[model samples]
Target: MNESSVKPSEQLSRTLAAGSPLIYVVTWEEERLEQMLARASQELFGDDRPVWQWTAALGFTSGPGADRQLLDPVEALSFVVSESVDAICLMKDLPALFESRPALVRALRDVYDHLSVRPGSMVVSHPSINIPPGLSKEVYLLELPLPDADELRGMLGSLNSGFGEEQRVSDEWLDRVSYATQGLSSNETRDLFHQLVSEKIVDVDAALAEINLAKAQLLMKENCLEVITKKYDIDKIGGLSKLKSWVISRQKLFTKEAQAARIDVPAGILMMGVSGCGKSLAAKTIPSVWGLPLIRLDMNKIMSGGWGAPEVAWERAIRAAENAAPVVLWIDEIENSFGFLNDSATSGNMTIFSSFLTWMQEKPANVFVAATANRIEILPPEMIRKGRFDQLFFVDLPEAPARIDILRIHILGQGGDPEEFDLNHLAKVMNGWTAAEIEQMVRAARIDAFTDGREITYDDLIHNIYRIVPLSKTMSEQLNALRIWSHNRATKAH
Candidate 1:
C-alpha cells in the first residue's frame, strides 16, 4: 500500500533488498510473479539463494527441500525462517488455508518478525488476500500490473517463432496481435499463444476472434458485470446534435494525426439529463460510431451482496473495465449507483468511491468512461468540479425537429416506412416526450397494425400515441427540478 510511483517489480526488489520480512503480492498472475521473485532472489542473494515455491497441492520445489511436500500451510510457512539457507518462498493460494487456520496465521507473523535480518523472504500471492491486522506491519502488498504493449509484443513474437519464414508475420500482424492482447495477464497471453501453436495457424484475423473469445469467457465468469456488444451506429441516435458534433470533433484525438500533434485523449463525458432521454443511447452511439468495443458496468450487480463483499465486487468490476481498455465504459444512472460523493457515505461506499477517484486520476490504461445520470442533484460537487470528465451535457426532452428524427429512426427500425407516416405532424403532437417514450409509441403502433390485420394506418399511430404519457408529463415536478439543477451546471446536449 505504499503510495509511490515506482513500478511494482521495482517495489518488490527494493523490499527484498531492505530485508523486508513478508511481501504480499495481490494478483491473479502467479506465473509472472514467479519470474519477478526469481529475478529478485538472484539480485538480492546471488545465484546460491534458492527461489522456492509452495502450494497446498505442490509444496517446496527448487530449493534445499526439493521434492519435499509440505501440504500443511503452517509447515510450508516455516521456510520463511531457516537462517542456514537463504530461500525466497513463494506462497500460492494460501488465503483459504489461512482463513480456516488461526495457528498458521500466528506462525506467519512469528516467522516474519524472526527473519528481520536473515537473507530470506516470503512472497504470498493470491487473487485477493485478507491479511490479519496483526501482521499488517510485517506484510507489504505489491500489485502486479497487467501485460503492457512491449510484453505483449514479445509474447506474440514467441508464437511467430513456431512458424516458418514463409509464414512469418508482418509488422502489421504483430502490431494487431499485441493491441488485441492488451489488458490480458501474462499467463492468459501465454495460453493464447499455446492455443495458437496447437491449432497450427497464426492468422491475424483469427487471432482477434480468439482474443475476444478469451475476453468474453473472462467476463462471463465475473459476477458483478455483463458485457454489451456494440450493434448500433452513431447515426441511429435521434437528437443531441451538439453532443454529436463534440464527439465527431474529438474523434480526431485518437487518430495518428492527432497523436503527432501531441493531443491527449478526451477524459470522457457525463451525460446528466431527464429520465427516458437519449443519455444512455448517446453514450453507446459515441463508441459504436467510432468502431470501438463497448462495455456497460452493472452497478446493481456490483452492489449486490450475492457478489461477495461490495468493495471486492466493485474492485473486480473496475479491473474488468481496465482489461477491456481502449473501449467505452458506460455507467448508467450514476447518482443512483454511487450516491453523493460527499464524505458522509458508508465505509464500503467510501472505499469504492475513493478507488474510482484514484483510477480516474492515475489509471494507465486507455479506457474511455461515459457516465449517465438522471438525478444530478444527488451528485456531490467534488465529482463534477473538473478533470474527472471532459464535459457535462444536459439531455432534456427532444424539441420539435429532434422528435421527427427520433420518430423516423424508430419507425424505420420497426420495418415501417417513414414516408407513409406524417413525421412532422407526429413530432408536434408528441411535444415534451423523451426519445424512449417515442420509441414505445412506435412499438405500440406496430401492435395496432397487427391487430387490424392490414397495413398500418397513420390513424393507428396517432391513436396509440394519445394513450401513453411521457415521463416529462407524468413526472413534471421532478423533471423541472432536474432542469433547474443542470441549467448553469451542464452544457446543452441538443
Candidate 2:
C-alpha cells in the first residue's frame, strides 16, 4: 500500500518504532490527531499512557501541578524533560515559539536527546510545518490527511443513528454524502452534518449542494483552489472528437472492473496550443463527462505569496486537491506557474516547479489533472514529457467541420436556427477563426438582430465576422510556430 493510504495510527506506530524522538504532525484537526495518538500510545506502551497536551493559553495540561499553568515555553520544555517520562507529550504551540525563542529550540534539542533514551516521545501538532533549521533533522514531519470516504461514511452512520427512523436516510444516501464530503476535515464534516440535520436537509442532491458550497468556502479561504460549480456538458462542446474519444475510453478506469483487472487510472492530459480553441471549455466539461466534482487550482494564487510562501501554498493546495480525490483538478494557463523554468529561475520558483513536476508524475490516481497551456514553449520539457501527462493534446483552430458544429451550437444557443443560415458558406468564410471567436461572432450577430427587432440573419453574422479580427489573422506568425512545433510533438485535439 502507498504511504498516503497508511492509517494515521499505523504511521504513528511505525514512526515511533523508528526511535524518532520528536514528531511534528501538520494538520488543523487537533482533536482527531489526539485521538489517534491516544490509540498509538496504548499500542506502543502496552497500557494507557497519559498524553499530556500543552497550549499557549492553557499551559501544561495533565500532570502533577497541572493546574499551576506552566505558561513559559522554557518552563514547559523543562517539565517535559524533568517530569513527563514514559508518556506522550503533545505541544500545541511549540512550533510558533521556535523563531522567537532560541533557548526553547536548544531545550527542545536537549529534550530530543533525552527522549531517545526514554520511552516517552514529544509530538508537535501544528497546522503548518515551520521547523527551525537547528532541529530540522531531529523532527519527523507527518502530515495528517483529511478524512477519506470510509471514514466519512462512518461519521454519517454515527450521525444517522441519532436520527428518528422516519428521518434516517438509506445506505445509498450515506455513501453519496461520504463521497461528497471527501475534502473536509472530520470536525468540518461533523459540523456540516449537524447543520444539515438541524436544517432538515436530508435529500441527497440538496445535501450535496450544501456540502459543495461549504467545501468551496473552506477550500477557497486560501485563494488556492476554487470549487467549479459551473458544469459544461461534453456533448455541447464542438469538435475535439479525438480528445472526447480518449475521455470516453478512460471513463471505465474508475470502475471496480478496472480495479479487478489491475488497470492503472490515467495520470492526466495536457491540452496545449492556440488560444480561444476550447481548451478551457474542455477542462470544464471533463468532470461533467466523468460525473465528478471539479476544482480549479489558481497558479496565480499559489505564486502570489498572498496566502503564504509559494512552496507552502502549493503543498497545501495539492494536499487539498488530493483530499478531494476522485475529482478533476483544472489548472488553466499552467505555463504561467512554471514560466521561470530557465537557468535564471529563483530558488523558490525552482522548488515550486520541481514540486509540481513530482506531484504530476506521482499524484494519486483518483485525482485527474486537466492542465491547459497557451504557450507550451515556455513550459519545461520535463513537464510535457510522456509520463508526466498521459497524453499531450494540441488544440488548434477549428477545422471547417468543427467550425460548422461550433456555429450550430452557438446559433442554437442564441435561439437561432442553423438550417436557415448558409452554415457551409459561413464555415468556409471563417476558415482560421477559433471556437471562441465563432461563438463571439454569433453572439454579436444575435445582439444586432435583437436590437433591430429581427431574427439573427446570415448577413449579420458575416458583418460581425468582418468587424472582429480573429487571433489567427493577427498572430499568424505565432500560430504557425505553434502548429509547426505541435505537429510532431502532440496528438491533434481537433
lDDT of 2 by residue, 328-351 (tens): 899888876665534446777778
lDDT of 1 by residue, 1-494 (tens): 56465666777888889888788888888877888888888898767566777777877666765666677788766654653466678878776676688887788887787777677777888887678877788788877777766667877787778778866667666766676677678778878777765675567657666665677677777766666653566788888999999988776464334433666888778999887888888888776555455678887787667888988888788777787665677888887677553433576766787788777877743678889988788887867768888899999999998899999998888788999988889998999998888999888888888887876678878998889977877899988898898888899998
The collision pairs in model 1 are none
C-alpha lDDT (0 to 100) for residue 301 of candidate 1: 80
Q: Model 1 — which ten-residue stretch has the worst lDDT?
A: 252-261
* Worst ten in a row by lDDT for model 2: 336-345
For model 1 the local lDDT of residue 336 reads: 66
Runs in model 2 deviating more than 4 A are 1-5, 14-22, 44-50, 60-86, 99-119, 130-141, 196-209, 224-227, 252-263, 291-327, 335-337, 340-355, 375-381, 417-425, 466-485
